[model samples]
Structures are given as C-alpha cells and as structure tokens.
Target chain A: MTRRSRIVGAGLLLLLVAVLSACGAQPVAQNWPGLTVGGGRVYVISGLPQQVYILDAETGVQQATFVPSGGEAGLPYWSPVTLGGDLAFVGFAESQSGTAGLYAFDPETGQERWNVPANDLILPAPTYADGTVYFGGSDGQVYAVDVESQRIKEGWPFQAEEAVWASPLVAGGQVYVASMDHNVYALDADTGQELWRTEVGGAMAAKPVMAATGEVLYVGAFDGRLYALRADSGEQVEGFDFKADNWIWSEVLLANDLIFVTSLDGRLYALNPSDGSVVSPYPYDSAEVADASDGLRASPVLAGETIIVTSGSGRVIAVKDAQRQWYWPSGLPQSSVYTTPVVSNGWVYVLLMDGQVQVLDSEDGGLQWSFSPPESQ
Target chain B: MGITDIWTVLILRPMLNALLGLYTVLGGQFWLAIIFFTVVVRLIMTPLMLPQQRSAKKMQELQPQLKELQKKYAKDREKLAQEQMKLYKEAGASPMGGCLPMLVQFPIWIGLYQSIIQALGHQPLQLLNLSQNIYPFMESISAQIPLNRFFLGMDLSLTPQQLGGLTYALPILVAFTSWLQTKMTTVGGSGGEGQAASMNQSMTLMMPLMMGFFSLSFSTGLSFYFIISNIIGIITQGFISGWEGLMFWKGMSLSSLLSGGGAKGAAAQKTSSTSSQAAAAGSGKGSQSGSKKRKKKRRRKR
Candidate 1:
C-alpha cells in the first residue's frame, strides 16, 4: 500500500473489530455513486439528502452541491446515467408528491438549468442520443425531454402499464425503458410515441443493454430472465433464465457476445447472446454477493476482462470467475451501494449511501480516496 | 415534509431500489446491498469530515480557555466580552464550528431517517408524496417489531419519546453509548467562539435521553445506525486527539501548574504557551520552519 493508503487503511483496520461487533455487522449508508467523468470533472447525485454534487475528477474536492430551491431533495434517479455537453441529465423526481421531472444541471455548478416537469417521484436513468434525452417516469410514461430548451418536447408521453423504474437506453434513435409493467418499450427519440413495446416475462427493472452494432437489445426482468430483442423491432431474439431467490433487479453486462448478469440468489450468471446460453465464465456465485438486506441495485461495469459489482451491504467484488478474486468492503452495514461502479481511465468511481463518493483501484479492490459532499452551510 | 413522504423519497424507495440494483449486479441477499450502500456513504463523507474533525479538536483545545473567560466575564460583562472576542480571534477559531458540522448532517440525517422508513415499510406516505410504493411488505413490518434491536443495549432510536427498559436492548444501549460518547467527545461549545453555551450542558444530557426516547418509539435499525455512528465517532475522536490531550494533561500536572485549578489554570496555561513558543523561536530552535525563519531573518537585520 502507498503512504496515504496505509494511513486510511490503518485507521479502518483499527476499527474493524468494533465496527463488526453488531449482528448484521455490515457497512453503513448506501449510495449509487456512479461516475459521469470527462472534461476533468466527475458528477454524481445523492439519493438521500437530495443534493447533486460535482467534484474535481482528479483531486476529488467537491466543487458544489445543488438541490432544487423549492422541492425536497428526495427520490431522483436510481441508476447510473450518461451525460452530454455541459448538461447532465438524470432521472429527476422529487421527495414526494407531483410529477417526476427530468432534471437538467450545469456540471460546473450543479445548479439547475431547468426541470422538465412530469407526474411521479420515481425516475429512470436517462441517456443522451441524437440531440435528445430519454428516461422513464413513475407516471407510466416514457418521456423525451429536449436538451437545448430543457423542456418536455412538443409531442411525447407514450403511456405504459406501470412505472418505468429502470434507466432508459437510447440506441439508434430509439429510447428503451424496462418497466414494472413487465414490458420494454422502444420509442422514437424525437416523439414519445411508441415504436414497439415488448413484454419479456417478468417486471423489467433495469435498462436494456444495446448491442454495439445496434442489432440486439439485452434486457432483464424480475422473473430472473435475460431476453435479447431485435433493435429495429421489439421481437425476442433469444432469452435465458438466471432463476434464483427473489429478483434480478440489475441490468445485463454485455462484453462482446458474453452476457453477464446476477440473480437475487447471489449468483453471477453468464449467458450467450446468440442463443441466451452460458459461454466463457458461465455461472459462478460472486466472490461477494447479496445477502438479506441487499437488493443488488448496481449494474455490472466491465474493467478489461473483469466484471466489478457491489452487494447490498457495500462489499464490492471484482471478479473474472467463481475463483477467489479481490474484494474491499464499506465499513458500515446496509449502506445500499446501488450505483454501478463506473470505470474511467484506470480508476473506478462509485457513490455510497452515507453520502460518500469513493474512488477505487480497478485492478485490485483497494480504495484510492473517498469524499463526501461539502457540509452545506 | 410529511414523515411518510420523506421516508419514501429520501430513504425507503431509494434504499430498496438500490438494494434491488445491487442484487442484480452482484448476487442474491439484501445484506450485500446494504453493505455496498454503507461503504459509499462513508467514503464520500470522509473528506468533508476531516475538516470537521479538525474543527472539533480545535474546539476541545480551546475549552479550558473558554471556561475561564466564561467565569471572568460572568460579571464584568463589557471587558469580558472584549477579552473573549480577542481570545477567539487570536485562536483563529469559529465559536460555532459544531453547528456547521451538525447543520451539514441535517439533510443526511433526514435522508437516513427517510430511507429507513420507506425501505422497511414503516412510513411510505412521505415518499414523493405518492401513495403508491409498490413494496407491500413495509406496512406489515412497521407495526410489530418496533424494529429496534440492540447492540449491547443501546437504543438505536434517539427521539424524545419512546424510551424505557421494556423496549428490549435499545434503551440501555442508548444510555451506555451516550455515556461513552459524552465522555470521549471533547466539547459541545463552538470551539470557544460564537455564543455562550449554557445549552451545551443540557445537550450532553439530553442527547442520549432523546436517543433512548426515540429507540422506545421507533424501529431498531435506525437506532442501530445511531449506535454504530456514535461509537465510530468516539473511536475517531479518540484516535485524532488522544495524543494532544495526553500531553496537555501531563503538562498540566507539572510543578505549580495543577495548583492553578480552574480559572488560574486557563490564564496561566495560555500565557505560558504563547510565551514559551516565542522564546523557543527567539532562542533559534524553531528557526528552521517557515514562520520562524521569517522571524530569524528579521532578527539577523537587528
């Protein structure tokens, strides 16, 4: 370990016994601190305390923390989002009551550029494509918000049966939302009208992963199944089951043709994209998987050949197989590290529930540094 | 605004959704999801907290001087006010350092409070002001368990109501944890800055009692965070200020120092410290450092 690492580690190691003294003895405070890095700045929004913060990507000193002046900083987006230009678009809902709006923020100041108003507080992650931002809402509508005007576009609000809980994916002018309605909707990016909406067994809670060639859309549902859909149309190409205990709330990680996903039963699964069958590192219980308190909200991020993911209690595992790999833990329990670990350059950044943003070394599950939002005055 | 809705948006929904997400990313078992959540929060807060910790230690170091000023000024009124302000300025301390850190924690505390209720099903009403939180299990569990478990008898809840021996281990733990916290933590005053701190005494007494009360009233899990958080805080404080305090205590015991008692101790100590440092620099031992080097250059001219 380096000098700084040793200081932090030694501080943590000293408290291990005391921290682990409780029954659940897990990490505390949960977060979905996914990375949206580029232009020397990294951005993340906290699920609690209802504020969004920006950091100096290199030093990690927080640049700002912004919350809507009028609304409560409540339930916003629950997944990692992709941003564009100076605008960072995330699923923007409020603490309670009213419509879930699409929140637009200035990455430099974390201030609101504008809010595209909607109906419920639950929000799906948003993706930028073809000059438009696409995300889902609890109002059971898939929304297309204009990036430039920061307003709900002229003709959109395609209705779905249930709330669109997962982040929306944009592939080839089509916005995809995996909804609790047990269906995945493929909508035209410009207009919110549905191109095609297909049901793939159970409630789909994760954003579908689109193929590089934009040929297939890989999505997972609570039924513990992974379905491959044709991009142009919403027809099922292939599907596989990761049947386990409760739900498969995470999205699929597609590395070329090898599809990786996890089930509520604590098993990491690998399936074939062509036929939804197991391939390379087929099926293995993660080196660290979810336990009773975790919902495994984080999606898997690929770091070269290894897949990195965090469990409910905040234990993050970086693995290539069922074989023992490297692991590090969030010292406190029930932290709810639902955010997917986002990798950039050689580092991985993630958010914690206790309002902490952590940076880790991808090669080993070692911590680089951790910072919290400025204690707002 | 409403507890139920706050619970929904800040705590329960986000926590569950994230938990659900982690389950999908890693494997089954909600515990891992919670773990992931915990690490993220700690790591994020670590940096901001370093400044807060330093402020806390500075507060502790100034306590003795402050207490003396509080006494000397207890009656003088005008001069007391002037001297105290000068002392604070000289110390370069914020009298209200504690509040800034605590204020910083308000949103987080609210978030945590909201998270537990929604995540556990105790209060879904506050979430997004929406009545529809698909998780039905919340209402059922919110009623029976009091949800509070004990880690060696500390009441995880810390509200004003709901404290007693009947609520399993939470109440006892609250008192014990608070005792340790109070004993270990240096001071509640504003690091000898800002305002007079009669309320701080009550704060020391009321916090644990309030925790005990809250434990009796609510779920054990929230109480659990409190217990762990307070315990962790004590540990961190111990590590950070232990040596300085030990040295201070030993230094105070030296010949003629202990004789000063309360007021005498304060004045004597502050003057001695300032004088001794100046003397050290004047004698050239401290000249190697930046500030002292400047003094050395000035002396060379003379």
Candidate 2:
C-alpha cells in the first residue's frame, strides 16, 4: 500500500522479467546447415530458415534457392542435400506446417519435383542409388523411394529396433543401416528383406562407409569405438576395432587406403582400411592448436592429396603428410563448425553454425570468399 | 571460470548426469525419468519451499488485522506503513519472507528444464552438446546414446502443436495443476488491496498462464515435467500448510466476500470453516469475528 512497497513490487516484477528473459527459450541450433558439393554447385540446407541454397561452387555465388513446399522458415531442413539421379533430395525431419517427408528438387532450376511424405521425422540424408532413393526415418525404419513414381518401394520400410539417425549406405544391392538400437543391419536393397545384422552394442549416428575393396564396411558408434564389419555378412572382423575417447558422430571418410574419422573429443584418427591399425603419427589431436580447444566434429574432406578438416572450435585446418599444413583465423573463430566441409575445385566450403559460409583455398587454408545468408523471411 | 562455466559445473552437469542415470536405471524410459527426477528435486527442495509456505500462511492469518490497520490509518501513509510492519513483527511474519526462497529456487527450475532438453538430445547438435556434458563414467548412458522419445503415442521431443490431438490436453492440465498449486500456497485475501496484494493477484493469474504457455511451446517432455512438479508442489504445500486457500470455486474475490452482500455469505462461511480448521492446526491466532460467531452459535443452542 505504501509508496516504498509499490517501488519494491515494481522492482521485483522487473527482476522476474530479467530472470525469465535471461533463461528464456533460446533459438536452438538443433543441427548445423546441411552442405554438400556436386556438379560444380554447392547445395546447402539451411537449418533455421529452412531454405536450400544452390551456390556456384567455384565462385560462392548463389545460383538458386529452394524453399520446400512450406514457405514458413521454422521447418527443419537439417538433413544434408543429396544429389543423385538428375534430382537433388532434401529431407525435413519435421516442418512447421505439420508435414514431414523427403522432398526432391530439380537441381537445375531449384524447383520441387516431388515429395514423399513419411509418418515421422526424416533425420538421415537420403542416399540415391540406381533408380531408387534410400533413407532412414525417425520411426525406426529405412524407406526406399522409387524416383519415377515418388512412392516407397514395395515390401519396403523395413523396421529396425530403434530410430535410424544415420544415412543408409547402399552398395551392391544391399542397404546398410546403422540404428540407435545399437545394431548395424544389412538389408536386401530391392526386396527390403533383412539379410544380416551385427550388434555393435552402441548407438550409431554416422553413416556406414564401404572399403575400396567393396568387401568391408566401417561404422562409428557412441560407444567411442569404430567397428569394421564384413559388407557381405554384417559380422565384425577380428582385431579390427579402434577406440576413441569420445562419441564418433561424423560420417567416416574413405580416401584411397586410409579411413579418416573424427570424434567429439577433438581427435582425428586415420586407419588403414585393411585392418583398423592407426596410420603412423595419426590420431591427431586438434585441441593442440591454440584456442582450438573444442573437439573435431566435421568429417574430413580430401582434395587431391591434401586433407581438409574443421573443428567445433571453428578452425579450418589443412593437413598433408600427417602434418598440420595451415590453420585458419590463427586466433579464434566467431562460430563453431559442425557440418562437414565440402571440397570442390580446390576450394573447401565450411559452413559455420551461425550461418557464415567460408570458402577457403584447400591448398593453403586461405579465405577465398565468405558470406552469411540473409535472415529467413 | 565465468558465470556460464560455474552454472554448467554446479547445476547443469550434475542435473544432466542425475537425469541420465535415472534414465539408465528406469530402463530408458525418458518420461518416467523426468517424472522421477522432478519428484526427487521437489523432495530435495522441500526445506526451501517449507519456509515459503509457512510464511504465506502467516500472512494470510493476519489479513483481517492488516485490513483494520489500513482503515484505521487510511489518512496517514507513514503511520500505515509503520503499523503494518509492527503487526508483521508481532506475528513473526515478514511480508518478503517468501521472496528470497522463491528466488533461490528459480534457477533450479531453469536448470531442471535445461537438463531435460540436454538429455532428450532430439537433434544432432543437441546430442553433440550432451556428449560434452556427460560424465566420463556414464558408459551406460553412452551406449544408450539417443533415448527413446515416443511415449504414450506422443513424441517427447515434439511440442504439443506438433504432436496434435490429445497431446494438446497436456497444456491444459499443466495450467490447471499450476493454478491449483498457486492457490494452495497463496496468502488469503491477496485479491483484496495494496500494491503487494495486487501483485500477488496478478501473479496468481499470470504465473499459471505463463506456465501453460511454456507447456504449449516447449517439448511435451518438459510440459509433462511441469504437470508432475506442480502436482507434487500442491500436495507438499497441503501438508506444510493446511488446505485453506484452495477453495477456488467457492470464490477467490476477497473484497466481494467481505462486502457482506447476499449469496456471498456462502463463500464467507466456507472461508471461515477452512480458517477455523487452520486455527485448529495451531496455524494462526483465531480471528475475533470467527470467535464471535462461535459464541452466537453456542448461545442459540442453549
């Protein structure tokens, strides 16, 4: 009732506002921008704005923007843009318009071709092979979409024990699915019948990559170990497991005879594909770089003989001959890198979580061009 | 370390670990883990919440005397302030007693929410963030990387709007339970007068609406936490302080009930009955008006 009491009341109200606003719901970056390079163009699936940017990979110029069926900006288009078979595919885990599915766009004009709706979130990037597209769904199933009819293949959508967050690896008539159920399954690609599955005892998020021999497959797990399984029977190979200090979420990159994998603990391991033995002077720790204390998350991209890597601390480093060649910023970066870097025409495209795209020369780690996409309308 | 680091170490990390531990123990049932975690947190915080409930009860007990003091010193502001403070002192109650404890618990509430979001790890980046917060020894949690999100036909990661249908009922239930908890802890006659009174009135309404809005906006898992936490809070408040203010439908408008007009006496009667019950529990000094009514009833029976 008193004037002082009124002042105190007003002050308390202001404090409540301050505290609530301070701990308020932040705009979360659930996933980094999905970036991939193909056909001389860099395709990016922006997270917050939910727009797909088709940029000229050489010049970093925006060639076309593909906004999916929903015009709203909040729909999730976090899956990597998959380019295959005359169409570019993007999967939205969930959309603000209450629709979720795999959407295909004409890469040339950035126009939508067809959308195959799914019952749940489409978390993994769709892999297009032969005439069909294979992708995993959050509903714990892998779907094969026929490109011609925009329909799921018959006897399809084989269910796994848990959600599949990793892109399916389609090779030699088999679909390899790594699921959160802690198992890697091999399914007959055409008939959607389970052939064999190997229990890794840890949830997997990284896509399975086949060895150059086409007889072995490599997949990483949250158990902090990378397992080598036979691509023919999905059985773990003896004495071929490599352990890391933390979770491996990045897809394993296979270049020539070496397998490059990054973990959340800032370690990058290069192993011989034949036996999972560490490459000499390998298991490079990215934290050794000054102010780059965060882990290495983005998968390494190989350009000619040079290997380009990005870290959660946002540093872009070029490594050659098992040595760090050049690192970017030389101090600290403004944003972290989570999306895998894309390499094309001697340029490495790194997309930071803050929507900044840095096109650095792959040979010297020099900044070639940089631009931040405009805010979503 | 800075404030953010301290918060992560002291609050976020511990909560994240405990919630994940509970998840592992609960066989990867994330919803059940959240519910159990909320109950454990409420139980742990009872010491802080007890003083707040008792303080509110004491303030409610002195409402009549406060009204009298206001009327007697209506013409003099300074005198009014002095008399109110003196009355509060005599009753061993402080008007600001609940504020400090409430402020202390605010961060815990926020931390609990943050932990839930981190543990859910619905998105890749969120999951990556979780990997950083997990304790080195939580290998079971590592093996169970992504927790199962769907429960009772609803995806725990999606908002009510995204879930749609029956999931929308969660926000309504959240608002109802929040209102019930607020009513149970609120001092009587907060709807009466004074700046403090008006603020309490506004808070009683705004807090539940805000909670409901948060329920609607946040993931269903968080909303589910809100409902369980509120229900526990209401029951805990009932045990700490007698169930005096929860007769919301009987009427919350103190001025109208005190105005002594027709049909309003029914609400007044219920209020006195509950107040007498509270007095019987040795919660407060009996009101003079209540004692007079008892005496009149005794005489009429004689």
Candidate 3:
C-alpha cells in the first residue's frame, strides 16, 4: 500500500475500533448462579434468558430444565438456586424494566411450585430453615416466605435503610441480614422484629458467615474491612476488624481453626478463629497479585487438605497449607469464573462465565469432564 | 497479552484509575467527576485538534482551485487526482491531517467508554469485574467500592430504558449536543451545493440520531459522557472557527449566524443565499480562466 493508503488504513482501523467499542455490543461477563447438590442431582442456573438445569451429579447429563413462568426475554438469574426439601428457589429479573422476584420450583418435575414477587431486583440466594425461606431484596427489605404456602410471611418484611444485597442467615432463631445502607441487623426469626442493628462502616454484600456454635459472625463489607461481630448481641468483636486493601465481596470461609477470606484486591487472608489476626506470613496472592484490578470473588472451598479458589480474572488456583499447588489455563483471555466451584464427592465442579462446567479431580486439579449448557449447544 | 487484555491494561485501566481519582478528589460525586474528566481529556487533545482545524481551513481555501483542476482533467481521473494532490501539497495541507487527530482520540473515546462501564458497575458481576480493574495504589478508590452511582435522581449505571420518565432527557441531550457539534464542524467547511453537500447534511443529522439511540440502550453514565464531550467539542471548535459556526435558536436570525464582518442586520436566509452565490461566482471565474489557458496551450501545440 502507498504511504497515504497505509495511513488511511490505520486511521480506518482505529475508527473501526472506536466504533466497535462505542457500538456497545460488549459481551458482558455472565454471573452464573451457584450450584446446588441434592437427591443425586446437581441444580444450576445459566444464560441471559435464565433457565434452571438439573443434571445427574455423577454423569453431568441433563435431567430436567425449568424456565420461569413470565416468558420474558433477557431475564437474568442473579440469585443462585437454593435447595430445601423437594423445592429449589431462584430469583430472576426482567432485563428491560428491572422488575424482579423469586420463584420456587420442584426440581424433579420441573414445575413452578410458588413465586413470591418483589418490587426490586433480587441478587442473594434464598436461605431455608424451619419451614421458612429467608432472603433479601434490592428494595432494602428482608422477606420471610412460608415454604409450604409460597407466600410472604405476615408482617414479615422488615425494611432496612437501603438495599439488602446479602443473603439472610438464620441461626439461633435470629435472622441476620446485611444491607447496602451500611448496617447489619439481627432480626427475630419468628416475629420479624429487629433485635439489634449494627453499622458495619460500608455497604455489605457478602453473606455473613456464622460459626458452627453460633457465637461469632464474620461479615465482609465494601469498606474493605471485615467485622467479626458477636452473633447474639450484634456487637463488634474487640480488635477483630481486619482491614484489607480493597472491598471484600466473598464470604469468609471457616475451616478448622483458620478463617479464609478473599478480597477484591486478589489477596487471600487466613485469619485466626479466636481473633481476626492474619495466620499466614502473607496472604496467598493470585497471579495478578500486584494488580488490584483483579481478585477472587468466589469464596474459597475447602476440600480435605486443599483449598480451591477462583479469581475474578478467571484462574482456578489450588492451595494447600498456604502454598500454591496449581493453576489451570495458564494463558491469556481465560474464562471468568463467577460462580463458586462446587466440590462434592472428590470432584470439583467449576461453572465458567461462558456457561461451560468443568469438573476436575479435587485432589490433583486435573480435568475429569466438562459440559456446556444447552444454549451453547 | 491479547488485544483485549492489552486494551484493558493500556487504555481502560488508566482511564478508570483517572476517573476514580477524579471521583475521589471531587468528594465522590460521580457526575462532577465525569464533567471534570471530560474537560481534562478535551484540554489534553486541544493541541492535536489544531492541525485538524488548520487542514480544514486550508481545504476550504483550496476548493476553487480544486474545481479548476477537476474541469481541466475531466477526461483523465488519474491526472485529476494527481493535480489535486499537487495543489494540496503546495498549500501545505494533507487530507489525512483533518482525520489524524480524530484517529488518535478514538482510542481515548473507547477507553473512556470502557472506564465508565468498569467504574459504575451496578450489577453484582459488573462489580466483580470492576474489582479486577482498580489500581492497587488507589486505596481511596478501593474504599469507595460501590461508588455512589446516583446523579440527579438517576442511576448512572443503568440504561435509560431501565429508568423511564425524566431520565429520557439524558438521551435527548446526548443527541442534541451531538447534532450541534456535527453541524458546527460541517456547515461552513466543504461549502458546495452538490451530492457531497447533501450527504454531509444527512450525516450531520444521522450521526446524532444513531448516537442518541445508542444512549437509550447504553448506561446513563455513557450518555452523560457523550453529552459533556460534545459540548466541549463545540466550545473547542468555536474557539478555532469563530462563534459564527454555531447554529442556535432554530437558525431564525441571520445576524446571529453571520460572523462579525459588518453584516450585522442582514436577514439570515438572504445572507446564506448571497454567500453561496459568491462562492459559485468565484468557482465560475476560476473554471473560465483554466479553460482559456488550456485552449491557448492546445493552439500552441498545434
């Protein structure tokens, strides 16, 4: 090409880049719902027009599919499937208008059992306990719905000052919920009355994890601080607020005496259970360790001696005893893993953003089998 | 790294960090951050823009000579193109000069767009993605995770379609400002009455409409960026080409449209008609002289 033509070609290429970028057909990374295992079936939600796929846990073959009733196109399933008894609960949003709600379905028959509607979008998966399903809504309310009747509990919708993006935790007959309004509340499970609300200094999205004995609760907030609160009194544990370099979006993992917490800054802190002190010499940094732009969102899953963690930039790293063991797909443009991998029966199942599920050997991080959703097929 | 990764690192990441820095400095007010960022970007681009403006002015001045060359070389397309290039070089102007700055700024525009999406992550997954792009040194930005997205009662992270009502005004403003900028840039230059002029006129209308439609579906933050950028571009162009290029008030008053050259009380339609007639008269004189010179050369060869 002549010099002028070459210059024009480069200019056109740059213009094309700008036009493509501005055209806004950007493929948004999908946030796959967390998987649920029950009755020999693995329940998963995937795709933009969200559908519930029930697959054989061992075979990874599709057994049943459930599409929400409204027949709305482009509705996304933000909340993962929550399995309790025979029913699976999922939340979906109408993409055009932002109207959203939760639906209960029978996994075996692929039938809609009940749906509890809400005015705003629902992101947190519903928690089931004591014949009551508890969840938070974007409308700044914690709702308790009856499992059998599939209706909102009477006088049961407790309002918060801002949106509640965290899943409600029910322990010791008290429902603990976190809100974007920077407050965490402990409500009476049966009466829906507020017991105590404590300000956590930032918007809370991660589900607060409670200890097995129900004495201490660890909540990560957008303020980059992890607060260990007394589960009963809703008071912060003395000197237990661990500050990270960035927001904490993943739930704190409690394994043995060590608490594993991942920050958006890509560092995983192993804290002491008694007090919020760093247990490791330094947090396990992902490959993008120095770069704060990428980090772990999928909470760490402990399988035997190994901890399986997925980073926001899409690398699945296996660490044992604070030592990095292995990471898969050692190349550029890795698929983002948004849903936490489900480790069950010695097999690690990872759902990628592109609707592909890779089941790896839990011990060695070797790929066993992979399955893509029907939409990809 | 792959192209997308390289783009994110070199363009999107820095722009996002700069925007977040502005957001922090502006006390977390996202709208103010957008406005200030737009101003900064435009100011940085000002030097590059001068070459484009100069080339445009030179191209306008060369129009009459270009017409003579076209008439002389009507039979030989190659000769006409060569003569055009010769004239352009003599005038110290390059056709690409008008587009080079825009090409340079294209990456910035795309980067700005990506920055907007990455910074104002409204959804959970988007927020997760945002976490990966933030700079580690920007502790202040990291602390403001879930940055305040609301500006003037409208969520900047949401599409205008998602927020019906007065939020529609953002898209309208985007279209209006875009159209105004296009008009200012295209109206005075390329002064002619032909298919090219009609095409330019249509483009001035169509580009803004297309952008407006895009804004309807895009996040409001992007729409805000488009509107602010266009306004800045108009002001920048005004400074270069004189304020007469601006067409406001539905083009009713002719005096306002004319530059301050003592045509103070002239009617708008009459002044525009007279200017076109004068341009045509000048082109006619050039064509006549060129044809006579060609005839004289033919006689001398015989």
Winner by TM-score: 2
DockQ of each: 0.01, 0.40, 0.29
lDDT, candidate 1, at A275: 75
Docking class of 1: incorrect
- Model 1 has an lDDT value of 0.57
Fnat per predicted structure, each in turn: 0.00, 0.58, 0.29
TM-scores for every candidate against the unseen true structure: 0.51, 0.87, 0.86
Judge the docking of candidate 3 as incorrect, acceptable, medium or high: acceptable
Could you give candidate 3's per-residue lDDT for residues A1-377 as a string of tens digits?
12464456455655654685455745443355567767878877655535778888888888888778773665464688888877888877766555577788988867887788887777788999988899888778888988878788887899998778788998989999988778889999988999999987788888899988789999998878899899978889897758887788889889877899988777888988777888866488885422345677778898778788887667788887777877765565346776778788998888877667778888777887777886766
Model 1 fnat value: 0.00
lDDT of 3 at A343: 83
Per DockQ, the best of the predicted structures is: 2
Residue-level lDDT of model 1, residues B1-302, one tens digit each, is 57856756665566555544553455543334444655555556667665666665555555545555666677777777577567556556554544444544545544555454444321111221111332443332211211222233533323323344545565568655764465345432222323333233334445566556555554555555556666665666668655232232432343423221212233335534543464465632121232354455688999
Give the range of the ten consecutive residues with the poorest summed lDDT in model 3 chain B: B259-268
Q: State which candidate, 1 or 3, has the greater DockQ.
A: 3
TM-score of chain B of each: 0.56, 0.82, 0.79
The deviation in Å at residue A54 for candidate 3 is 1.1
Candidate 1 wrong stretches, greater than 4 Å: A1-35, A72-82, A96-100, A238-245, A287-295, A330-334, A374-377, B1-302
RMSD to truth, every model: 20.5, 5.3, 5.6
State the TM-score for model 3. 0.86
TM-score of chain A of 1: 0.82
